[model samples]
Target: MQFYLDGYRPGDPEYRPAAPGRDESSKGAAALPDEVDVLIVGTGPAGVVLAAQLAEFPGITTRVVERRGGPLEIGQADGVACRTVEMFNAFGLAEKLVREGYWVNEATFWGPDGTRNGSTAGITRTGRVQDVADGLSEYPHVIVNQARMQEYLLEKMRTSPSRLVPEYGVEATGVEVLDDGGDYPVKVTLQREGGDTAVVRAKYVVGCDGARSAVRKSLGIELRGDARNHAWGVMDVLAVTDFPDIRLKSVVQSPAGGNLLIIPREGGYLVRFYVDLGDLDPADRDARKRFTFDSIVAAAQKALHPYTLEVKSTAWWSVYEVGQRIADRFDDVLDAERGTRTPRVFIAGDACHTHSAKAGQGMNVSMQDGFNLGWKLAAVLEGRSPESLLDTYAEERRVIAQELIDFDLRFSTMMAAHPTDPAHPELGGVDPAEKQRMFTEAGRYTAGFATEYTPGLLTRSAEHQAVATGFPVGQRFYSAPVIRLADAKPLGLGHVAQADGRWRIYAFAGAGDPTSPDSGIAQLAAFLGESEDSPVRRFTPDGADLDAVFDVRAVLQQDHRELEVEALPAFLRPVKGPFGLKDYEKVFTPDLKGGRDIFDERGIDRERGAIVVVRPDQYVAAVLPLDAHAELADFFAAFMQPAAALV
Candidate 1:
């Protein structure tokens, strides 16, 4: 039950290289075979991790293709967050990063000192970082170059059992889905890259090709959101400075111009700065665009105090205008106007959602998008999941993408606005109150606290759903709960569930003698009673049956709650045997977490009580909010037992 509860830390040992023969490459891109079970485009964080996850699954032919050729061979690189690193460890890339990357602990804030102000002590740090959760995770965060990571992935990928074709760029200019709805096997198309073109076929296709996603366009799906060109500078340099704040600083700033951040990496340093060329007058804008490298260096020097800052060679550098956008529908038909029919096309990374990279969440969010999707897709592909499970990927990830964009909007707005105050530049433009607010929120996001999936139904629609529900699942985060499997206890009612690892929920309430094998739920209850991962408590039949303590199912029938409850992540399993659970509430009962449900929390009472159905993923199936348990149950019965419904 404690598996992955607290993520792997510096020396926690989950980090290890792949079993060589399975991942290493065998032949050149041209020589490699063409067909596969899954073809993933783009080898960025999203693609790489996805490939890694899929490779571990048996009977799946997965491949990773990057138009840009090999890893670290090109492309500008950046840093990795704790979450990214944690994932890397899972896929066995963290150790490589740790060996080749740098560790940064703190960040600094700077502001303009004068009209041509040298610099001001705006905010002293990027923001307070999260203290490593005790026994929850090993390292809080790490700064590693993007290219280096790609290199590491390339080496590891060479041995992947999945067929990997790194340089075969997809010319998915226009593709018609041959099997639009028959489980997407053997898609036929022609591909062109490097002045070469040919026909190709694959069982599946993934669009990780980024913003100008070929798969998305081929599906004829149009992006559905706004895009803005935000100005920002990122440079990875060999700084010749003994600046004490180098390792500690996260965000650097200025008043008259944009600021710089000292990303104290192991190789050297990566500094980032924000700029706005939009409001600039024509002359200033044109002149600045054509500004020489000298001006950029000058800008850098102004922000960071130099000891002997001579420009060593630039390891990687790029200036990106930040932008934000989202797709209207997860999938669409490829008709002339908007595609005639929906294709089994899936898009991850920037293709699905794009946003300005400020808090370093772009990579993290993208990786998470892949994580939430990869396992589920594999499930569907393996025939373990209902086709409806695939739909959940879009429904869930869309909200996450929206959350990122919203955060970036607020962060970027406040970041670009220079504080009018000089004495306390860190305060931005407002008084102490606003400064405190910024710091608090910044700390929360920077610590990755704002990143967890909500416990609310874990359902797709959030409007009528509650944000938190279920027993211990999605109930608490930062550490998955520990349950005594032997005791068969409930783990998530509030004080259980952590995001670090999966959970194995059980119940000692099964029928039979507490000592009989039938009371194996008893053995499970006993084991969970001592497990150290999450809190496990036995149910009290008299007043603790949960029926008395909370009106869980009752609230549903009353339409008092609207959100669905989420099951704990599927990874959690029985410690040493097949998992088991009490029969699902043999019958929908009147018990609901008291009369206090999500809607009731808002002080809104329903005119009539109805059935509050809970879906498998823990979202409100439907809030009948009326005491019609039979009717509500019948509707769901139709959903799960279609054939039975007709009879």
Candidate 2:
């Protein structure tokens, strides 16, 4: 496999494991056909990101499977959004996307008469202004097309010493997971390019296929969602339209027809126009199938002006509608009861939560599925987190899917709307905020940055640690800052922090710096980067966020807001002392708990005493204080990597 991922073309006269139950030898290493620590079963954003993350662990033997002709090595339209920028930075692909991509800082939405009703801040905040989307995820919110991203990921996977060689394109099919109330290894069946069947077995099998995943169905796990019979043809055309005009008109409706979108993409402006394939109307079902590109163009021309529609081919295009968010149930993963977690046959990405893109969350949310599921899988593959931790995937992600579905529901209503106008007839409802939330949320779902974890194995029996009025306390926020007050440099702490960042314990020195010499800590007082700090996300003292968690009000007493104490508890505040920004000890109280811990003793350590177990992706997995180490190993035993499975 060492030479295979070294940019090898894959097909050889003698080597062929592209069949079911087939095995191959590479780098003088011999293993079973199914022996692998982590087996990824797709190569899209989710699959590729998972492979890249697992590839970071040397002991884990990682393998990636794609059903396409390798990574899409060329740029194409579709699957692009302004919210994926953070993930790009995490995966070290930010620079490429930012340089070659467009920084859609300001997007204007106009009413019928060029009256801009809504505004979206461009993704970029200008030179060295801390890219609003940086460190948010493994990728960024730029339009680089699928091929560009795939090529970059494929190249990185190739250079990985612990190579996760992309294997067997779509030729590979069928994955069977064998589990009987205990641990059941995964068996995957693959059909080579030439009708040969190969089977590869592994400890874990991840399904990254699209919504219609065969692996998901094989597990009998029915994804509960609306499989509406609606067909929407996407146009990746090259034509300059009066997009600048839409700065005033959010929805363009003419006598001819109404086009939904007027987006200016990289190559050209992409005007999203809808065609009634009549899939939704049983009466028009037959007529819908006959709908063609010319029909798509005809409808678009009616709404758009100064445009000659020349279809420049489509990419990753599909036709589907509003789906639900509910999964089968805990019984699906375990027994009838949610007690003994037995859920196997993991399904991530679109396969798990398929929804209408009317909310502009298809690509953004799909990638988030990967971010949510990536680390736990890596931990299980690395022998660090627990198998019970795997249950969190559904617990946390299910909530996200539910929210996304709701967002889509609102968007569907908005898109089907005509501006409500009493003065003029063409106008219907003017409500755009409900509709705008989708894009903004798409821009700031803050998936990887979102820290709220629904009660699962990790948060089981977690009691809130009371903070004092003086201690530098952070409440339940996604991430806290490692403010180096010495130079006043406030380090952005996402799940994935940069160099000089392994495990940063944000303790306090007690002494508040009016103007700390250190720029690092000084910068910490600056704006908390969460999508331009809009009003929709206003953080009050009572709001559950970093301020409420860390209780930073004492430092900037006036401007800072902390939750109004029911009784002004003394425990939630920051400890006071001459906090030397220079010394880690002087600044960070060693005893201060990061709230959630993997093995922290409950009583021995104060309420604020807990350790944070951050995955390589930078997310807190199991947070416990001292004395819970046993559970840590158990957690790792079930969730972390398999010791025997690792290379």
TM-score to true structure, per model: 0.64, 0.64
Tens digit per residue, CA lDDT, model 1, 386-486: 44555556666777788788887777666555446656666746332343356445654544435544433232223322222222122112222222222
- Worst-scoring 10-residue span by lDDT in model 1: 638-647
lDDT of 2 by residue, 436-484 (tens): 4443454444232333455455443243232222111121223434332
lDDT per model vs. reference = 0.47, 0.46
Query: Where is model 2 more than 4 Å wrong at Cα?
Result: 1-32, 73-83, 113-141, 170-172, 179-184, 243-256, 267-279, 283-288, 305-326, 329-338, 421-451, 459-505, 512-647
**Strongest candidate by lDDT:** 1
Candidate 1 local distance difference test against the native? 0.47
**lDDT score for residue 295 of model 2:** 67
